[model samples]
Target: MAGTTLGAASPALAQKKPEAAKPAPPKLSKPVMAVVMAVQKLQQAGDHAGALAKLTEAAAVPRAEKDDALILAKLKLFSAQTIKDNAKLEEGLTEAVEAPSITPDEKLMFSKFVAGLASNRKDYGKAWTWYEFYLGQKPDDVEITVQAASVAAALKQPARVYELLTKAIDLREAKNETGDRSWYEFRAQTAIDNKMDDKLLPSLLGWVKAFPEPKSYNLAIGLVKQRQGNLDNNVLVDFGRLMSAAGAMTDANNYLEYADAALDRGMPNEAEIVLKEGIAKQLLDGSKQNIKEFVAQAASKNAESKAGLAALEKDAKTSPRLALVVADTFANLKQYDKAITWYKTLVGNAMIDQDTVNLRLAFALKNSGDAAGAKAALANVKAGPRAIIAKFMDVVIGDAA
Candidate 1:
């Protein structure tokens, strides 16, 4: 009888134990879950406007509270991007700002978006305010500092730029445990722009000591020395050391300017020596072989040298000022045809002022024994002071013709 009863209970008891007191599945609010699902579907379909509209409606729906802050912030960003309406965008942003659950990353993203929108509308003040807010939250942000400095520069607030850059430099130095050499360069340039030469001198000196090989620093120092009427052997020696360390290349316009300064100061002997030394070092080092091409090109156009102007001309195509220099060099060498060719190129490309090109073409034609071409070129000259001058010169040339 016991065996019979146990067997009878066993099958039912096993089944009942498996089903007894099972925890109910967590109940998701159907309406809220549906709204979230709708938002996700709309976003996935690239219908951001629809997504935001759904989110806005869901935000107003009572009792749909879980993940609300996240959903609202997302809706705000999507709405801001979709509407192109600043008022609505700001409204969304205000909501986001109020959402205490917003993460720092989300805040940064929203702030940048607002700042870009404000900037596009030329609302610089608003842009600055937004950027400032973002920076306050992330104080050591170098990219923001650089951007703020640039914006301040564009706004013509040099003092503000200076302050921002100074702070950025200090922050960078503190973070790296070392001083920033570029900051000194920026300060020197700012001082130059402001005509605060006395301030510039110290900054320049500091940059030179810090970044001696940056050629520009040396050039700045040389300029400062020249401005102070100190173009003596001592200054030359310092420049020479910088040139050697930088493997001074003659092709650089800065080097040419330095040479010209030396020559202008009655130091042609020194200028020649420096050029020779630079050329020798450049040839031996092979670091600045391009300078050789530059020098050869200049010499080829020299009436006394005629070295390799063609190669230089080819390279000059990449540099407008160099093209002009080549043309002038040809003119000075009495290669009037080559000069006229370049001058015509300049005119055809509209690279030079129309009036200037016409006058130069007139002169080139006259010198090339094409008095008629000269007269015709002058005819293209527009009526201005330059045109009047060209007409008068034409009459004189015509009389001679």
Candidate 2:
């Protein structure tokens, strides 16, 4: 007993509009009109059972014209609605909408109305069908589209939910409208639940770009990292950098992964930086044996690695990978000028991907407080995952870039 009712005044008893604006009502026979009036009076008097009985009698009247049938159907709908008889109301509504006298506008309204009734009854499949019908007629109805997506979700149709909500969200954004936060959340969550990895990044990127909340940033970066499955250490380092820049290093695992990836890539200085920052942020328990081991390992080679950087820079010209490794270490150590120089040195080298070089240069430039330089470098990144990450970084740097 939710105590909910469709409490609006019945359409049958709606006050007539100005003659110029109103469509002509279906002409009812003498018998059907008399029954219709009686049912309305009974409903107004709160005699729902009598109102329904009168409509049932009206249904039996011999109908010579389509208007007679249409009037009878509307009377049944009004009576059924008065008594809150959902089954009869659904039947009456379907009959009324199919009548020859029903306008396209009326049919669309009925589609939405019946869809709501089905949702209230938790008949999601029926609700989805009705909602689809309404949306087919009026695809621009964002609110209804979201409702339909919700119904599709309840029916365990994740792909359909993704399709409907993505269209709605993109449509709103195209109009320069900010969508409701929940819409983005639903779209992202649906992608995650379905393990739609291909869809996850774009879904999250759209969400974080629009909302730019810390929690969403964490999810956007972290979820993709979690699902990427055995990335190259260099790629993992890039992921770690993005997560760190976004302030999305929410757990010890994030710190550990970043540090381990740096260590594996022969960048002890970078590992040391990540481990130290994690400890300072209280996100890593330094007293833990594994963390203690990492801290000591990161420190063991860190100084020696820095000492060898001059020699490394000499060999960097022949090895773009070596240069990138050194650049990443410099960036991690907050030596952004050296990092940017090395990243730029590798640009258009043909031996290494120019997009990678540019994207890395952008990261270093942005860290160095040169947003314009960062954006220029980012603009050169137009291939693979780095391009996508570059797009996200552009949003992070904001319009100032």
Candidate 3:
């Protein structure tokens, strides 16, 4: 490398020139100064009222007009602090909001002060207005957004609360941040109360999928059952399956709906099974009158199946499938003896799933007034997903007994 003489004149390497001395701050005009001195004297004497009066007098001075905005705001702020009156603080804030020389920090203080004052006074509408203004300056502030949502809710503005809370949750999600579970609940209840029927289920389902919480799942499934079940049988079954699997199907209405849907789909066997299980859990009626509405068409089915079951009995001597039909139909119809006999025959002699047949026989024997036989049949069902249910049923039935 060649030796180079670097010149100091080069702009890139040159030292910066010394800065000039700052100018003195502008002085208040004579009348303004006089009023300020008077206010200061009153404040020193702890006569805040007198100081505020002096400040009010200064406001009318035509000469103080140029700086009057800041002067008036400062007076109000001092009075607010002295009297500990948020209303005075809010007055100062309202004036300060229009002051050109107010710092961003001061403006933020003003906004928060006014919002707190309004909130404390239970003037939620006005609080929402101030908070909206503040949050408008900081759209991504999740905490503030949630606070605004609470204020909106207090104001009985369900739609607004829903919007703000969901926004807060979404912002948190975008940042991959965890959120308050209550936020999810707030949005859900808001959506429901606001008659946001379209948004309610989707929001709850989102909560369930996102959080996988049991309470959220229950609310989501309950909303689905209460609001959308009447739309179609498929909706009922599809949603009921998820609800039941999640153990969120605690409501009798939900059990009734699941059975009702199965029945409407011409799945009487499934419906009958669901109803029996629900009744066993005391989630549905065990009495004939109590279950009357649910099995309205069953009497007609029983009469029709009578001939078919007779035919199945005749053919069952040759076909195990026919025997299974008799077993399933009679089991569904509460003809437990026949169902147990057929189910037991299949469990031992047929080339079918013995565990499945054993499970069916357990239910049949239990319903046929044979607790011992049911226990014996259930004991044979060892190791499978169905075993979990068998174990649960055993414990539950044992508890009841």
**Top lDDT model:** 2
Residue 185 error for model 3, in Å? Answer: 3.9
Candidate 2 accuracy as lDDT: 0.79
Displacement of residue 354 (Cα, Å) in model 1 is 56
Candidate 3 segments exceeding 4 Å error: 1-26, 47-50, 53-59, 62-68, 119-132, 149-162, 189-198, 209-215, 229-235, 263-401
Winner on lDDT between 1 and 2 is 2
Q: Score each candidate by Cα lDDT.
A: 0.57, 0.79, 0.66
lDDT of 1 by residue, 284-350 (tens): 3325575455444443333232455677688778866566656644654557899888877777555
Expressed as tens digits, the lDDT of each residue in 1-401 for candidate 2 is 01112444545422223556667667877877777788779878988778777777666777666687667676667667666677777767767667787667777777776777778788877777788889889999888888888888888999988998898898899999878899889899999989887888889888988888668887777666666567788777777777777777888888889889889988788898899899999989889998899889989888878888889878877888888878877886789998988888788888888877888898899889998898899899897667767877887887335
Worst 10 residues of 1 by lDDT: 1-10
- Cα lDDT of model 3 by residue, 39-134, tens digit: 778888988777766766666765445555666567666765665555555666677766666556566646755676677677877778788888
Task: Give the winner by TM-score.
Answer: 2
Per-candidate alpha-carbon RMSD to the true structure: 25.1, 3.8, 16.5
